[model samples]
Target chain A: DAGVTQSPTHLIKTRGQHVTLRCSPISGHKSVSWYQQVLGQGPQFIFQYYEKEERGRGNFPDRFSARQFPNYSSELNVNALLLGDSALYLCASSLAGGRRNEQFFGPGTRLTVL
Target chain B: GESVGLHLPTLSVQEGDNSIINCAYSNSASDYFIWYKQESGKGPQFIIDIRSNMDKRQGQRVTVLLNKTVKHLSLQIAATQPGDSAVYFCAETWSNDYKLSFGAGTTVTVRA
Candidate 1:
């Protein structure tokens, strides 16, 4: 089976602009989560959606939001982007939303804010 | 306020030698731990995982040792090879929590 997949592997946006990144989870997976990885740093959790409901959220600002579809795909949106927002946006999927499941990650979308 | 952290920023070893990476976590409540390997321009790949109930778990060529008492975690690579060069991160999570707190990561370089 294919692993988690992401779209628009690379994106360039300007300050104050908005950008959307997409992710398609592995087949039979139910939970999807988003994380932001800055260069030279580990990934920071952003949002987690299970059964299309928000299950967990990280310390990110209100400018960041995400939603999951019925098919378990997800979209991460950043509004009024800042230079600090430039990083790799990663998506991970698990069989469920709890600690019992192991998450599989995608290649991630590289967002460059100019 | 709980977090995970690594002891060293980088480690260099000969291709035939063994590699050991260490991590410390502040959360005593954390029961699940995982180790990930990330290469340049790629997402983290799962290496191995161990739960608080267990002290050690071994994979193909990797071993994860968890010390719940010391709140420490370590990953050991046997007969390290060039393909093992990458950044390794340790993550912790509790039973009820869906989020994982990751450490800064340790970069390993294998010299042939």
Candidate 2:
């Protein structure tokens, strides 16, 4: 079966613009999480959704938000993007929420903010 | 304000040799620890994981050792290959929490 999949592999936006990245979880998976990976750094958690409910959030600003659909797909939105927002946005999926569940990640969408 | 961190920023290992990467976490409440490998322009791939109840776990050619006393974690790659050249990260999390606190990552370069 295919792993997690993301759309718009690459995106370019201005400092004040908004961008949305999409992710489709693996079949049978019910949890999805978003992470932002800066160059030369490990991924930082942004948001996690399980069963279409917000389960957790990271230290990111209010400009970042995410929502999951009934099909286990998720969308990450960033508003009023800043140059610091330029990074790879990764989406991970697991069988369910909580511990002991292995998460599979997507290729990620590269967001470049100017 | 605890976080996971790596001992080294980079490592160079010769082919066929074993490689060891180390990480330290400050959160004693963290019960689940995971290792991930990430290549350029790609997302991280789960390598292995261990719970606080266990000290060691092994996968195909990879071993993860956790020492809760010192809050240290290590990943050992047997017979390192060129394909293993990438950045490795250690993440810590609680059993009930959904966020994964990740380390800075160690870059592994397999020499020819």
DockQ of each: 0.72, 0.74
Model 1 spans > 4 angstroms off: B1-6
Q: CA shift at B3, candidate 1, in angstroms?
A: 23
Give Cα distance to truth, residue B42, candidate 2, Å: 1.5
Q: What is the docking quality class of candidate 2?
A: medium
Q: What is the TM-score of chain B in candidate 2?
A: 0.93
User: Model 1, range A6-102, lDDT digits (tens) per residue?
Assistant: 9999999999999999999999999999999999888999999999999999999999999999999999999999999999999999999875688
TM-score per prediction, in order, is: 0.95, 0.95
TM-score of chain B of each: 0.93, 0.93
Clash pairs for candidate 1: none
Ten consecutive residues with minimal summed lDDT in candidate 1 chain A? A96-105
Per-residue error for B21 in candidate 2, Å, reads 0.4
Give the distance in Å from residue B28's predicted Cα in candidate 2 to where it truly belongs. 1.0
Write down the lDDT that model 2 would get.
0.91
